[model samples]
Target: MELIERIRLHAARSPDSTALEWPGGTIGYAGLAAEIERLAAELRGRGISTLAISLGNGPAWAMLDLAALHAGLCLVPLPPFFSEGQMRHALKLSGAQALVTDQAVVLRERLDLPEPMGSWRVAGRPLSWIDLPGDPQAVPAGVRKLTFTSGTTGEPKGVMLGWNHMEPVVRSLADAAGVTPSDRHLVLTPLSVLLENIAGIYTALWSGATAIVPGCPEVGLIGSSRLDTAAMTLALDRFRATSAIFSPQTLQGLVEAIESGLPRPAAFRFGAVGGAPVPPRLLERAAALELPVYEGYGLSECASVVCLNTPGHNRPGSTGRPLPHVRLRIAADGEVLIAGPGFTGYLGEEPPAGEWWASGDIGRLDPDGFLHLEGRRRNVFITTFGRNLAPEWVEGELTLEPAIAQAALFGEGRPWNTAVVVPAPGADATAVAAAIARSNLNLPDYAQVSRWIAAEGPFTPANGQLTGTGRVRRAAVQGHYQQQIERLYQ
Candidate 1:
């Protein structure tokens, strides 16, 4: 069944219970339903048979999403930080009837964000269900939510999921993550894609938990971009958030709160981190805050998480076992192959014969069955001496130092490993190089970053330093920094 129908069921079951909460906000099941209906009514009338819904992690974003699906329009969710070129490409390919966005890139390119509302506040406005007309025509059977892979290698590939394909993944994730009706979850991802969509909101509600989308003050220095980390602490304290799935970047903020002797979320129990390989130090720091943070592993193809550590089975470096009804196996080449309730296939690509997706990730199963993500398949580089190196391994190690924000390693068909790195603002490049030199001492001689050069500036989505989901785009960085990397060899 669609998430809207499930929401209807819950609203009927618990109309008076709090269904959503954010800092300075709260909504009951009945209130949530009414708002969704109003949102559906408003958009379906505006020739929005298919909506390209653009929203950051927030209440209004969730409300619009559920409402759009309930209103019978196919929805395409955009990652929040897509550059103008990327957004335009995705919007055009999505065949969207209308666009919705708060992304500055969208506005700078004039994608008609504010729409007929004549204001950027429509996403946050409170309109009653009574304000909307009766629901419009329902969506067709193939109607779906479109999620574009972050274009890490090249152009983005849209992954479409029929209403039939998504429900089971939501239930499985909620079960695996151990969310319950008493739990209040702070949504820490943008709403424009399936990764955060199913894992964040749908799964939270499936478990009867409350999900909050922090209200952004306005687009400014102190807006959502800064994220109300301090305010999040207050909300967690007040709402008693028990469980959350977060990007590692947000986990870093929570680490600060813990170090400062601030009150930890009392009900906060289980948390998971994704979007990158988290350092053991980060996880250890999170534990210091009394937050049990597990590193999650998945891609848009896996519908968010194929594996994650839950309450009782916490393991460092491993993204727990697969959820129930999900099947995982290792291919001969070490690729993590999956057959499960998640990710049927890509939009244009033919479904694999067995309904299995070979996660481009190369990983292995420990004897205990927990999975460890090794690195990307394309990342394997053979040095001039035929030494195969996974640059991701070296890079993951280098970025752990607070002074370094980005690192790319290259030695493919070359004499030795060379690195081009971006230092954190105001960091000493010379000292960082010394640290790198020191750190590499522990690594095998062949795998070590034998030489290094400093990057001129941070890598960006525009220039391909980061994927829309915020994971460092390795290929782009390597390509952009080829000259600097070569200089190390010289």
Candidate 2:
């Protein structure tokens, strides 16, 4: 069944059950259904077919998203972290006919867009509608949603997905995570990202659970990459969240807070960590702190999660077995390929000419059927001595040491591997050097870090060295530290 039908069923079956929770408010299932229907009617009245939603996480955002589906309008979600250029590119590329946003004036000033066509109130917030120019971009038939991937540089590409591509994944995720009506799923990541949108909120709603939707600041997100741990703890405690989706860096911060004596939420049942490669030690630390963290693997092209580790069926180092709906196979060259109903196609791009989507991640399926990912195929670097190394493999080992906070290995065509190390606070050069030495002991000689230089500071989105999701932008880092890396080689 469709997501809209599920919402209606929840309303009919349990009218008084809370469907969504935000700061200072809660909307029950009946009330949520009413609001969705009301807004959907308003959207249809306005003849909104291709609508763009550019708002922060809240009840209105949730309402409009579902309302669009009910209204039979093609929806495009705009990530708040996107640059003005990216926003413009997305608006034009997706051919959004109208935009619904809370900060219309701000966005207009930032993007130099025209004045709003009009305004309307939904869920008690005044939202403006800006009419876009030209005909809407032609998308493949059956495309109901257009979600853009968060790229490291340049404008992100839009991935078109329909109900057929999304609903099954949501159902499979709810099953794999054991989501039930008792689960209070917290929305920590932005709902614009397909990961949080599908696996977090959509799955929770499908399971008839309460979804706690709060603004990013309320959940400890200061900007794109930085997180405020105290705020996060407070939000988790406030909502009594049973499940949440987190990026690896955010999980690390939460783990550190718990280790430093912050109260861990006893009600927290499951935490899905993904969006980047997670170090196995981090998972071990989280387990030690009594935090149930399950690492997963996914891509925007695949409509979010392809494989996930869950409580009863988890391998610490492997991204768990593929979900029931998807088929996983390892290519002869070691690329992870997914064969499933997911991934309709990319907007303005030809569909890949194959039954399987090459995930571009190099991985191996263990005898137990768990998928163990090494690194991105494009991220593998060959040393001057003919030794091939995946930098993430080495970096993952380096970060296992307590003193080494971050490591960016760069040695393509160089004699030996070296890194720019970001040391943990109060760590001295000797300590960082010792940590590198300890990490090298665990790695093969060819992949070991032979030399290193201390990073002047942390890799963050503000510095353009990290993506919004907190993955290191290796090209940016390489360019920023070219002198240091060259000096190490010399």
Among these predicted structures, which one has the highest TM-score?
2
Report the lDDT tens digits of candidate 2 across residue range 70-171.
Answer: 787788998877777778888888888888899998998998878997778877778888888735545555677899876665457889888888988899
| 251-287: candidate 1 lDDT, tens digit per residue | 7666765577778887778777887777666787777
Q: Which candidate ranks first by lDDT, i.e. highest?
A: 2
lDDT of 1 at 72: 71
Clashing pairs in 2: none
Off by over 4 Å in 1: 41-48, 102-141, 216-239, 260-263, 342-344, 349-351
**Model 2, global lDDT:** 0.86
For all predicted structures, in order, the TM-scores are 0.87, 0.94
What's the lDDT for residue 342 in model 1?
53
Query: Root-mean-square deviation of each candidate, in angstroms?
Result: 4.4, 2.0
Each model's lDDT: 0.70, 0.86
